[model samples]
Target chain A: MKLALVLPLLVPLLTAVACILAGASRVAQRALSVLGSGALLAAGLWLLRSVDAGGIQVVQLGNWPAPFGITLVADLFSAIMVAITGFVALCVAVFALANIDPARERFGFHPLYQLLLLGVCGAFLTGDLFNLFVWFEVMLMSSFVLLALGGERPQIEAAVKYLTLNFIASGLFLTALGILYGQFGTLNMADLAVKLRDQPSGVTLSSAMLLFVSFGIKAGVFPLFFWLPASYHTPPVAVSAIFAGLLTKVGVYALIRVFTLIFTADPATTHTLIVVVSVLTMITGVLGAAAQYEIRRVLSFHIISQIGYMTLGLGLFTTAAIAASIFYIVHHIVVKTNLFLIGGAIGHVRGTGELKQLGGLYRDYPWIGLLFLIPAMSLGGIPPLSGFFAKFALVKSALEIPSYWPVVAALAVGLLTLFSMTKIWAEAFWKAEPEGATGGTRGPVPLLMLVPIVAMALLTVAIGFFPGTLLDLATRAAGQLMNPNGYIEAVLGRTP
Target chain B: MPLQLAFSIVLLVRGHNEPGGGFIGGLVAACGIALHGIAFGIPAARRLLRVPPPMLIGTGLLIAALSGLPGLFQGQPFLTGLWGGSVPTLLAGQLKFGTPLLFDVGVYLVVAGIAVHLIFTMAEDQ
Candidate 1:
């Protein structure tokens, strides 16, 4: 059990080292990358199974006791997250075999990629707030290099914006950490939950707001999400897919963790604020997507809109709502990642992602078109697909609370989301090739790129077909979030 | 230059019980290397460090990560320190060895390599 908890962090660190040592041989590094991701997935699944069967798993590092030593805990929510991260990392690693150019590969892409996974797994598994900050920095450093690896003009421009904004977000997070430590004298999340409940609401609210904004920026929420769309499309498609699938979701996970576990004191105020931000986030994100002509830019905007849906469950602050949020997160991660990979496939085939420049995908490569349609329709919340269930659960929970405005906004945003999806389908797939266009293949589409896209699309279909098992797991995770005593107990070991 | 390097090693070793640690010690060593470069030339400094900066960084990270495996083997959590009996040294009294010390040594190499790499890059650009 203890070994399982550390595997997610240790495996990636070791893989990165091996990649670095074998840096001269591109083939060796590539093999090691795939092997590492495979190990990560196995470890994640093992940890998830253990946590599911035996309850929350905790390991205190270096023999230090709780609240002092670095604590690594895997609740069902975190285990699911870590497992999904491993899954996505594997897919992206495979896709990069074709998507990344030789020059970038030689620029240490494999080692940096492994480091990024290490940081992400560390973020998900860590139990301390300050430790979370450290992991965030690790993730930030690797991703910054990944974004700028090619050093193209557009990439450099996007990297600057990304770097500046994320640093500010980190600054806000650090300030919040300082305030919390001053107030409670502890940075262990479980310890804070116990100490915070007795404190005056006013003091906690300030730190909560700071943390919300910090995580809010990372999650791409309203009034602070400008960085996402401006920069996401500039990187290589494989990088974009992993970033889309995992990066923002970590912020959402932190929001869910802190809001549920640590800041349950004044939900009436904090959650209400979240509801307002969520609705605004949804409306604005969908509107932005509707206006975009580029495939990736459209998908990036949708990331923000979908984040609103995930946080809405938190704002609703009910057991069912949180479960729906978890369900939504799982479904969105798979669907959105598939969409980006399909976009990459489209780019590979057509030599461009501009909808106007793209055409005849449905006519020439119907297999690719079919792959694209699954995730596209799923993202639009078409019935019987994964999105439908996720949206249905969230809407049901919201209406149960009788929160009518958010419901009205949510349904409207759903329609807008469909409009954008159809727009991409029509412009990129259904239309004929424009005059003076090459009208045929850019080059042979690499099977490596197509494999992960198909796999993720199949995952979308599977989740849509078998929502019951995942929903049950999500409900159990929500139960843990609603009552964090189990988490607190596991970390602090039966605190009086 | 040799005295400076020796002093930095002292800082790194005593860091477990004193104010000095890997980061400061590495910075001090990097400074010594920089001073030598300023006086004796960049090639001389580079020759003084036998390996490339990146190799140092990678090796340091490898050592740090491997240092944790002993505890895993001992059925403790990852990074749990396992101390060995003290070994008598000629200069210092009995010096104890443990995973923490190994971890610090790894950090020292990494920090020093990074500092030197930055300095070399900046100086070479001129």
Candidate 2:
């Protein structure tokens, strides 16, 4: 009933068009970018507050009723996600001012960036399976252009890789949707949830598997995640930061959203499969990180590893477990994006991301080094930081189920994560610079760039300091998740 | 009638419920405009349009977005279809006065703008 549901998508859509309309004036584009993002942040906060207080909100497009019309639904998980999306978009928009080359700007980086946000917000807010597919395409289209925008040889090569794998994933998702629609005659997610309950056909199971593989590829799980590391490190850091922060999580959010709300008929077999995937994803991701010599590449691999923890939260499938996953997602988005931004700053100053060739950063730039250490340690689950609480919540949930294997995998990943962080610390910040090192002589790092890094770092520290509110929110989100009845009631106006 | 203009008019009029819409119709127009650009060159096309492509894109998008606002005023969802009570004019016949039709017009302008801009800019590049 709430009209606020539409704002999340509408605001971003308007912002994107505004950015495009600004055209050729980099200053105007930047101004529009900031203003649009600021508006989006407000919309996101407003959405979260209303959803948190008023409960799940569904906006029927053009006044059509549910199970028929395209709907934008805002549950707690979606609201939190939309809120964080605005924050990341705001930070990255500012950072791009300094980070993206002027050449890219002239090629319409600002508009494309806003379009990307539009697509992302649409994906988060959509309540129809088919609508989700459309949004995914929107996101993928913009991402493809953004990745290849600069036309660098590496950018092109990596863009092809990024584009190919994601296209396949989209095809798989679309195929899954086609089958589900054929069987149920509905694309509305809540309607599907009602119809598919207690009906576990072989066709349904196979379709579920298809969805798993599809979202897994996007989420960057084991064996399906090869494209992520190959391409993520190749983009400009701001682009990579947003990509790292939000893109894969959309896949993860989809996984959690669909499996919990629709595919609950065969949790025994499907959940088991996810658990095994989580273990391998963790082990392989950390191992991959260990082998990487570049800072971005190492961080890229860690993204896979950290994803395993979130999947572990999903695999456990308890209220607390899902809550932990939600918490983990927020913490990772902030910490990981900040890591990439800091990496960008280092590359800016030192002229390279090659770890061995980089050193003595702590000596010359202790402030930057300290900024790096906070997120890095938090990532490794250092005590009194964000990651530790996120890890603790997941492990505690695992123990409640007495599921030892995922707990073991989660613990080992934490240790290896620490090892990888220490490696980056030793090579990039602690050890002395290799003789005759040179970096970009763009003078000192500009305030525009530093501001985002510091803001994100402070946010991470604040999350560490005040875990109670977020934990409560995650708990409430998970509660609504475990029982989809409220969501169904909200959308359908009665129990199915 | 010119082949380009005839084809574009057909495509634009037949778009909404048919297979073709703003995208294809605009592409149709773009083909005609592109031929014009190639034949007469970029300067001639700019002179003919009387405005730049970027401006076209902006105005088109503004129209598209503004077309949705009235729905919000009526307490309905944004961009919901809204038809008019007015009798149709000769030109506006078959095309209802509604947000949906306006949206399509907006899309047509946008598609036309983007296609022409890319084509012209690339032409200038060479």
Candidate 3:
């Protein structure tokens, strides 16, 4: 059972090595990447079931036991995140197969892709704070290469800004880790939670704030999110899809883990900070999304806005709120990734992602049109879809907090989200196709790419219909997080 | 030219536990590559390296990220290190083996790869 936690991280690392040794053999690299991701997907699902049937499971590595060595933990939250990451990664891999040119595959795409997954899986499962930082670096490094993979003018420019800003963020992260370690003398998250229990309020508040700010940059929270829109659209579609689906959510996941477990005592400062940021993030992100004329750029900006929804749940700081946030994260990842892939397919067919150049795609590519519509509507929080359920749960939780402003802000964001989705639909799919367009004659997206999109879309709808299962898992996960004692006891023997 | 020398200094400073490590090392190495491209020509370097810079960067990141896994399940943080067993081996007498060493190797590869890539790109422009 513990091996389940270890395998997801191990499979990708081994596969990456194999790919490297294979020396750019396209077939071998692709096979290894796909096989590795498939294995991870299987492992993720198994872990998800185990968590659901049982509860949080902890694996201590190298026989070192907890608090002294490294620990991999899979609660409902981490398990669900791992599952979503695997599903999206598998999709991205298939999409890359179609998207990456044969010549480039030999370079480093397959191996890097596997390594990126390893980082993400590690981030999701690790029970320690410093380990999270390492995972972030791992993810960031791969992302830099992927961003610059094509090495076009825009890519280089974008990569420079992206790399520079994230470098600073990474530095800040390290500093924060040093501070946390200095303050508590421990980097293990579970142990820190226990040790921090009796700490001075000032120290606790400051440390929490420092950690929040660092993660906010990565999560693209308001004021720190300028880099996201500037760089996200520069990448190839597959890279953007994976980044959109997984990276920011890791930050959000970390925020939820820390705030709920470690810093639960001070709701006034932390929760208020979260609430303020949530509103601003929503408003600014929607405004950015609304202003964009490019498909991918709009989607990228929306990533910021949608993150507001998750933060809203965190701010509310209740079981339902956190569960809804988890649910929202799951829905958003799938829908957002699908939307980006659809944009990619549109670009592949239209020769550009620009709205002005793209038109009447719905008629030319009916399958893609359907695929895009599902996620689009889902993202808009239309009823009878996963997005609606996520929003509903969040809204209900917000209202329960009796916070009128947050409820109003969430409702408004939903409307704006719909508006942005419609804007894309209007310009890219509904408008008249330009005459003599280069991609007008291009065929429909290949089955491999479309299958994953459709599968995600189906999952979105299915979860919407039956929210009980996921809601249960998320609530259980939230409960575990809220009661840090269980986690502390699991990681450190009996709280002291 | 002076920038490369400065970068080397910074990398040295970063070696202990600060920010400088492999990533900075790679960037510095790239500066050196760029200098070579300026001195020589783009195609000449490409032929010499036999691969692109982005690939190198990718490979480096992969190696670096993989080095952290041993700690992840060991109940430590992802990149946490553990050292054990002084080797009583014939040649070396005693040696330390741990995750951080693996991470350092990852840093080395990533630095080398990115350095090569920066050089390649600069050379291409020249």
Candidate 4:
């Protein structure tokens, strides 16, 4: 059972080592990387099923008990997130085989990719705050190298900005951790939850604010998200796709976890700040997307807006709202990743991502057009898609809670989200290929590349169609979150 | 260079309970390699390493990961300390050699691999 508990994280880490061991054999590395991701997927699904069936699962590394040694605890939310992380890893590995160039592959892309997944799984599973910070550092360092892997001028430039901003966030995060640890004498989240509720302090609020700034930058929230749009467009499609799908969400996860678990002392203050920031984030993100001309840039801005939706539920802080948020995140991850892959596929065929330079994709490649439409319409919250239910659940919860301002922002952002998706649809797919442009069919997009996009798109459609079970899962996850007694008991035992 | 290599080896061995551990010892070892690369030139140093520096990373990682597996076999959690029954040591007093020490050795190799590879790449670039 403990072996099953750690497999989701252990598998990726071992795969990272295996990838490095393959050493200069790109073919060997590719095969190993794919196998690793497939293993990760199987482990993830197994953990999800087991956790879903059996409540929270806890395993202490090196056999040290909680609050003293690091614990890996997977509750409903964590198991779900890990399962999705593995799914994305599998899809991206397949895509990278076709999407990444040989030069990049030889530069140890496979190892770095596996390492990134390892860091992500580690972050999701670890129950210690300090361990979470360590995982953040692991993920950040690998991403920095991956971003600058090819050493291209633009990538190098973006890497500098990305690293610099994230370093500031990291520094702030570390400072907050130091402060919390100094005051509370514990870093185990459950222990902190038990401790902080009994002794509230001014330092806790300040420390929480510091944490917000750190996670805010990483989450790409308004006023701290400039680095996202600036650098996200500069990476390779595979890099951008994963970064778009997973990285910012880690910050959001941290925010949701800490707020729900430890910072309940003054939800009145922290939750209000969250609600205000979320509204601002929604407005600015959609507006930002509306302004971008490049396909990836538009998608990048929408990621910010989508993040706002996820956080809004946190701000609302109701069980239904949080469940809606969880559902929204699940829907958004698949949709956003598929959309980025679509952008990549178009770039594959047209040699550019500029909307002006791209056109008649619908005319030339109907498959790409259809693929784009599913996620695009889903993103816009069209009926009978995952995004619609996600948005509907959130809207209903917000209206019920009467968090009126965020509710308006959510609906307006949905409209603007649709506007930008159509902007992409009309410019990239609908309009005739401008004469003497990059739109002439270079060739069919590689089968390996197209397969992942289709898989994710079909996943979106499947979730939309059969959301009863998944939504029920989300509701249970939200229940576990709103009442974190199960999480606490799992970590600290019943009496403690 | 030989003295530095010997000193680093001592540090690596002495690292389990003492101040010097895998990271610092690895850096010390890399310093020795850097000195040799400077004196004898890089190509000769590269020839001496035999295996490429990057490959050392894989080897070191596998070693470190493998060190953690014995615990699982013994029905403990991953990475539990499984010390071999007490062994007496000169100067260091009682040194218990086991998986923890093996883990440190793995870390030593990994750090040395990374540091040397970085230095060599920069040196060769010039």
When just chain B is superposed on the true chain B, each candidate scores a TM-score of 0.92, 0.84, 0.60, 0.92
DockQ comparisons of all candidates to the true complex: 0.75, 0.62, 0.09, 0.80
TM-score of each: 0.97, 0.96, 0.84, 0.98
- Writing each residue's lDDT as its tens digit, candidate 3 over A418-482 gives 99999888887888977767853287677767777788888888988898888877788888777
Residue A29 alpha-carbon offset, candidate 3, angstroms: 1.2
Candidate 2 on A1-496: residue-level lDDT in tens?
Answer: 3557777777767777777767777888888888888788889999999999899988887778998988889999999999999999999989988899989988888878888888888888888889999998999999999999999999999999999999999999989998998998998989999998988889889889999999999999998999999999887999999999999999999999898998988899888898899889999999999999999999999999999989888888899999999999999999999999999999998889999999988888889989999999999999788999999999999999988888888888899999999999999899999898876653577898899999999999999999999999999999999999998888888877
Please give the range of 10 consecutive residues that has the lowest summed lDDT in model 4 chain B.
B86-95
- Per-residue lDDT of model 4, residues A316-354, tens digit only: 999999999889888888899889988988888898999
Indicate whether candidate 1 or candidate 2 has the larger DockQ: 1
lDDT of 1 by residue, A1-496 (tens): 7899999998999899888878678999899999999999999999999999999999999989989999999999999999999899999999999889899989899999999998889999999999999999999999999999999999999999999999999999999999999988999999999998746477799999999999999999998999999899999999999999999999999999999999988888999999999999999999999889999999999999999999999999999899999999989999999899989888887888999998877888888888888988888889788998999999999999888898899889999999999999899889997877774366666899888988898888998999898999999999999989999999999853
On TM-score, the leading prediction is 4
lDDT, model 4, position A20 = 84
State in Å the error of residue A340, model 3. 0.4
Single out the weakest 10-residue window by summed lDDT for candidate 1 chain A: A436-445
Query: Which of the CAPRI classes, incorrect, acceptable, medium or high, describes model 3?
Result: incorrect
Candidate 4 chain A has its poorest 10 consecutive residues by lDDT at A436-445
Give the Å shift of residue A162 in candidate 3: 1.4
- Of the candidates shown, which would achieve the greatest lDDT relative to the real structure? 1
Query: How does candidate 2 fare on TM-score?
Result: 0.96
